[model samples]
Target: MESSTQLVILAGLVIGLIYGAVGLLSGFCLMSSMRGWLAQGDGRLVRTYALAMAVAIAASQLLAGSGMADLGKSIYLQQSFSVPVLFLGGLLFGYGMVLSNGCGSRALVLLGRGNLRSFVVVIVLAIAAQMTLKGLIAPARIALVQASQITVNANSLPSLLAAFGAAEATSRALATSAIVVALILFAFAHPSFRRSPGQVAAGVIVGLLVTGGWFVTGFLGADEFNPVPVTSLTFVAPIADSLQYAMLSTGLTPNFGVATVAGVFAGSLITALATRRFQLEGYSSPRHMLRSAGGAALMGVGGVMAFGCSIGQGLTGLSTLALGSFVAVAGILLGTAAGLRGSLRVQPLAVA
Candidate 1:
């Protein structure tokens, strides 16, 4: 193994540990957060997510401004941004998360805690993601992406702001900082939320970890001769890739995504065990299993089409200031709202 690959993998594991720890500690699940806001009128969790995004955008943009990283090369910054596909993907992913009771990252955290239901979810999600990415659903996905994509000279938010008359440097700083400030204020505006130090810490730490993911892949792991793909944390393709690695270890080497995914499970397991929260769990009935499986399948397909999962687009992709990230996130939120209360709400699953 090359020294650089080893370093990347090690870095990925450390970052994953931090992210997973924060996630488990704070109950960091996008699906739950959104549902909390829309269905329960509880905004604390949503605020946590906002805090995470704010930290990610500010820190990531700073790295780019310092010339330490090139976020422009990320998949989120593609010249041709697909609108319809992202919307459809978000819708599917949002509703699926509701049905499964969690998002991809949340599922990983749960799996580490001995939740057999999460294990099933992880497996089904991976298989479904693989199908959408390169298997049975690939052709249709490609067609949808190709048909819905729009070519832009600059598809990123900062660039668009600059185009609208802000100076490039000012635009980047203003665009990024404004969102961060608003999120920070929103997160702390409530006295109740302000009192929850653990939740606050989780948001900040998770957000920084997004920046950390970018640094590991874009800066520390950069190799001009054998350049790794410029990316940060995301779970869609990585889940599928992780499953593939497990089955095809003899022929394949681990990448940042796979290592990070593996690390999430490991980190969560360690945390769960240490905290004495490691209890084995599974579905209560066949119907519960079926709903979860169906949800996992939708998430797999939707995540691929949207090009990211909640943390993938919500934080990692948004870190790049890409317009598509904004769009996809909006779609995800809309879909989540629907599933939580609007019209697509699934019945509650029985707890085992």
Candidate 2:
């Protein structure tokens, strides 16, 4: 069982590496998608992201319905829900992503393109996230979780459908189909989005990567003796966890999240180097540097509180159709809007 679990984890690493390479190569970024749609009136990026979310939901549901995996064991669909944490975390993460000029996946893409600022953002995000996850701030986080917990039996939409007397397979299939159709309709409705094959393909592939992470950890990492935490892609805490693992690897075993984070950075680096895009750059000003650092720290704290970042809870967790994930995603959208539309004077880079 242990060996089998190890194999599963190893397979997840490989899948993660593929995902990282594709994401970097294609410049996939949920943050940019959302921000662009809201701020610049260009909905293509957000539409692509939505399409990916739909694919992730449909594929994950199919996997679960076929008995290939069970998403209930994953952290996103935990029986206990916390609204304050989810909302607060989402707000922080959204603002942070905006201030840093990217999310985790975006950082990886930019790093590949020789952006030094993104490198600092990634490093700060990883460190601060680790600080919130299991380092100095963990005690406070635990206490908060204990205080705000709300218990429920069926945390996922599929399980809710199952409660309504639908057969397990039927419930999952119907739910998944509804979401996929909605997403497909939305994506195709926008002519601009429909024309971008790179964005479309990136969305679909990234969505699959989320589902692939679930399979790698939930099914593959399952073991009677040494079970792993159920999770998919999320940037905030995992970045921190990766940093922690680098320092404490002798005392801890590699988990899917940590491995995936490492794979994303390394895979992007390889792609960048191979394509001659790798370079080191930094913030244009002290104010910009401050924004990046503060954003990363807030993302670390908020991501842990909310249970995921945009990709983690928004795409990966939502794939399970979990109620908490939905709430978190909603909060993310709202928070992102606040940052983009509010009085803070958030501006896009020229990127020339």
Candidate 3:
């Protein structure tokens, strides 16, 4: 209703559009990247992902450093968090991503390209996330958090550094520089990745979009009377919120998340149509459908518990250097590894 809110919503839509387009064009999914690197022995996509993380951290920290945004206000920087719960959630979301063949954002992009399989994934994931957030699963989730959550003086890497006697700005700069440099070096280490300019650009743009989301909420929407939630790009809860808003439009007002979700679908749809990439697709069989549905449900519940999905914890949350984000990301990587390799790997379906 307020002008600042409207601006934030508009910004969210624009950011989502860019993200959807970039994701579709560049194949920017962590699951796919991991599979490529670990299974197929390709590393370009993974490099792009690493670059995105680096850029996100650099840009986000710059914003925070300049006092343009308050990174501390975000949920990832909580003083008390349950390590076990977050790690478990990440593992579930990661394994589910492998089963579903993508994350929530990827499903949205694919759905826009007329993948009926992704449509199923999106719907089921949303339902599962909603249930976990507020339905029958909420009590259990809450209880677990209450039981395992621990309090700490330093909630993030930078904060921890500061607690160890480093100046606030010095801590932020040191942490950001170290992580960003390492990621960038890793991304550029491969000649193959260095050759793909489009992928490189996609990574940069996606990272900027994450920072843009923070700016929209933390700066543009920082109204004293109607303060918006200081947050950025994360898919799990947003996708669920989008679905709820769709069904209950009369009572609910659209937020940045809802607008971004809708924009992602619309952007991907338009791009697919223009590029002649839109095509109808469906599950191969009942067994395939069951697998997808199960994966979606797991992703829903897991994403909620972890406080983010691949893009959420992996990129946006990590940009803040939160200790819990590191734990969750580690869990996700391990879970993805389990699904992609070793005896526990989910094998390719045999075509009947």
Candidate 4:
């Protein structure tokens, strides 16, 4: 039998490679999607995002229906609802993404594209993630979660459907199909989006990546002896976890996120070098740096509280159709709107 670490490491590398290639190729950016719709009146990027969400939900539901995976095992989708936390977390994450000029996945992609400013965002996010995960803020987080915890299970649309008398497979399939079809219709309805093959392909591929993450962690990582943490993509904690692993690799074994994070930067660096996109760029001013720093920190804290960044909870976790994900996604939209809307004067600060 293969060692657990070996299996996990292999999965991580594979997932990482896929994500890196996809990130580099498609220029997938949730922050861009929200910003485009709000700032520029362009909905192509948002449509791409919606397409991915639909595909992810459909594919993940199929997996769940097949009894190949149980999405309820993931952390973000709790049985009992926490509306306040989810909304607040989403808002924080959305604002932070705007401040950083992109979400976690977008940041990684930008880093590959010779944007040094993204490097600062990633570093700050990672540090803040660590602080929230097990550092100074961990206790408070734990306390808050415990204080307002509610008990619910399988908090997904499929579950709700099943509760309403639909069979397991039927309910999952219906829920998945409805969401997927709606999203695809939305994407195709736009002429501009139809012409952007690069963006469309990226959306589909990234959707696959999200589901693949579930398969790697939830399925392959399932060990009767030493099970791995059941999770998918999310930038905030992974960065911090990556930092923590770099410092304590001997003590802490690698997980999918850690491996993926490493792969993103490494793969991006390699791709950038090959494509002549590599450069050392940084903030032109202290204010710029401050915005990046603040945005990253908010993403860390908000991602932790909300249970994911755009790709993490919005796509990967939400694919499960979990109730918490819906709440979180709503919050993210609200927060992004606040930052992207000029009427609110949410200007992007200069970098340090």
Candidate 5:
């Protein structure tokens, strides 16, 4: 590979390491946060999540505004996207996250702590994601997207504002300010969340990490001759790609995503070991195993269709202010709500 590619890969690994450690230490899972807020009547974790979103938006937009990274290059900024497909995908992924008790990133962190059940989740999720991305499910996914996708004049929030009347910089600033302010207000409104400094730091660090991923791929990896993909931290496709690379190293070349995926597992493992938190764990029963497997499959398929997982669309994608990301995120929140409240809520499973 090129020298720039190596640097990008190394950066990806570092970013993943930090992410894994922070996620494990802070219990940074969207499903868990939602469950805590809606079901358990605790909003601290969700507040942390909101802060992370606020930071990600502020930092990412700054990078883009400074011409350091082109957010336009990312998949989330596509001119044409399917509202139905993306929303449906988000709903599936969110509900699956509830069923599985976590998202892909959380599973990786838990697996690092010797959760054998997460191992199953990781493997099954990877396989299912791969199938959706390029295997048997790809054709159907592609057909659906092609059929339902709609073209829009403005792909991102800033662009939408620019189209109306504002200059590019003004539009970006306005949009970013609106979102960042709202998120910050939500995050800091609760005294309980404000008191949790560790959670606050995790949110800031994770947000910065998302920006770091963009810097690595969009700036550090930028080469006229051998250009690397302008992307950042997202686990769905990367987890699948990591699995494929592990099995087919002879033919595949490592990229930012795969390297990050490996680093997350390794970093979480090290943290768990150092903290004496590592302990082997598995499914409670066959029924539990089945539920987990089914959830994994749904996450894989849904994540692919939505073009990201929780961390993917919720944080990284939203950082770009993409319209589709908003749609997908809305779906994810609604889906999570469905699983957390009302008649559709998923009840706690009984131990076997």
Candidate 6:
């Protein structure tokens, strides 16, 4: 294997392990967070997410400031910002997260803990994602993006600022600093969040893991002969890639995303065993399974369209300060709110 490939695999494994371990330990579920905040008035998990976003934005911008990573080259920073697709996708994903009571990453962690239902979720999600990406639904997806996307000269916040006469470097710094400060204030505004060390740690570690992924792909894995796509953690495409790898190991080689996906599973399984959190679980009935399956399918398709899942768009994409990320996040929040409190809300199991 080439050195670049080896580095990518190694970095991906390290980051993935940390993500799994931290996620498992912290119970970091974005779906749960929103549900808790909306349904029960519990804000700890929501605050945790805010902290993670703040840290990711700050750390990622610092990495860019130091000239180590070119985040602008990432897919999220594309000039053709898709609006309608992202809005629709985010809506689907958020609603699905509520239905399934978890997102892709959460499903992985739950699977590690022996949730057979998550196995179904993973498979369905992967297949649905694959279909949207390159299989049956590709044509429609392509049409949607092509029709809805609007191209800008510069899609990043800093570049947009520069277009308004701000110096590029100054704009970048100011943007990063301002966003980080605002997020931190919001995250820490609640006294309960400041008191929860585990939640705080979860936010910090997960955010840094995202930055680490960027460094690996954009910096260490940067090769003149074969430059890796500048990317960080995202679950949609990676899950599909992992499924393809499982069936075509001889013809295909594992990349950072695949390795990261595998590592998360392994890391979470190991942690669950070591910490005595391992337990077997399954659906309450066929109806439950059907609901979960439907949710998974929506999530898979939506994630592909939006170019990310909750964590993918929420943290990794948002880290880019891309205008589209903001739009996507808003859609997700709106969809989640609808699911949690509106007519579309999916109720929990009635008697199980």
Q: What TM-score fits each model?
A: 0.98, 0.92, 0.99, 0.94, 0.99, 0.98
Can you tell me which runs of candidate 5 are displaced by over 4 Å? 350-352
Number of clashing pairs per prediction, in order: 0, 3, 0, 12, 0, 0
Q: Report the lDDT tens digits of candidate 4 across residue range 214-285.
A: 787778778878777777777778888887888898888777788888778767777778888777788888
Instruction: Give one digit per residue, the lDDT tens place, for model 3 in 1-352.
Output: 9999999999999988888888888889999999999999999999999999999999999999999999889999999999999999999999999899999999999899999999999999999999999999999999999999999999999999999999999999999999999999999999999999999998999889899998999999999999999888999999999999989999999899888888888889888998999989887789888988998999999999999999999999998999999999998899889999999898776432
lDDT of 2: 0.79
What is the Cα-based lDDT of residue 144 in candidate 3? 99
By TM-score, how accurate is candidate 5? 0.99
Error of 2 at 124 (Å): 2.0
lDDT of 1 by residue, 134-168 (tens): 89999999988888789998788789988888898
Clashing pairs in 2: 114-279, 116-281, 130-240
Residue 248, candidate 2: C-alpha displacement in angstroms: 2.6
Q: Which ten residues in a row have the lowest lDDT in candidate 1?
A: 341-350
User: Between prediction 2 and prediction 4, which has the larger TM-score?
Assistant: 4
Error of 6 at 268 (Å): 0.9
Residue-level lDDT of model 6, residues 1-352, one tens digit each, is: 7899799998998888888888899889888899889999999999999999999999999998898999988989888878999989999988887777789998988888888888999999999999999999999999988888898897878888899899988999988888999989989998999999999999999999999999999998889898888899989899999999999999998899998998888889999999999988888989999999998998999889888999999999999898888888887888788888978888888423
Give the whole-model CA lDDT for all candidates, comma-separated: 0.89, 0.79, 0.93, 0.81, 0.93, 0.90
TM-score, prediction 1: 0.98
RMSD of 2: 2.3
Q: How would you encode candidate 2's per-residue C-alpha lDDT over 242-345 as one tens digit per residue? A: 77788899987777777777777777778878888777776767778888788877777878888888888889888989889888877777777777887864
lDDT, candidate 3, at 2 = 94
The Cα RMSD in angstroms, rounded to one decimal, for candidate 1 relative to the true structure is 1.0
TM-score of structure candidate 6: 0.98
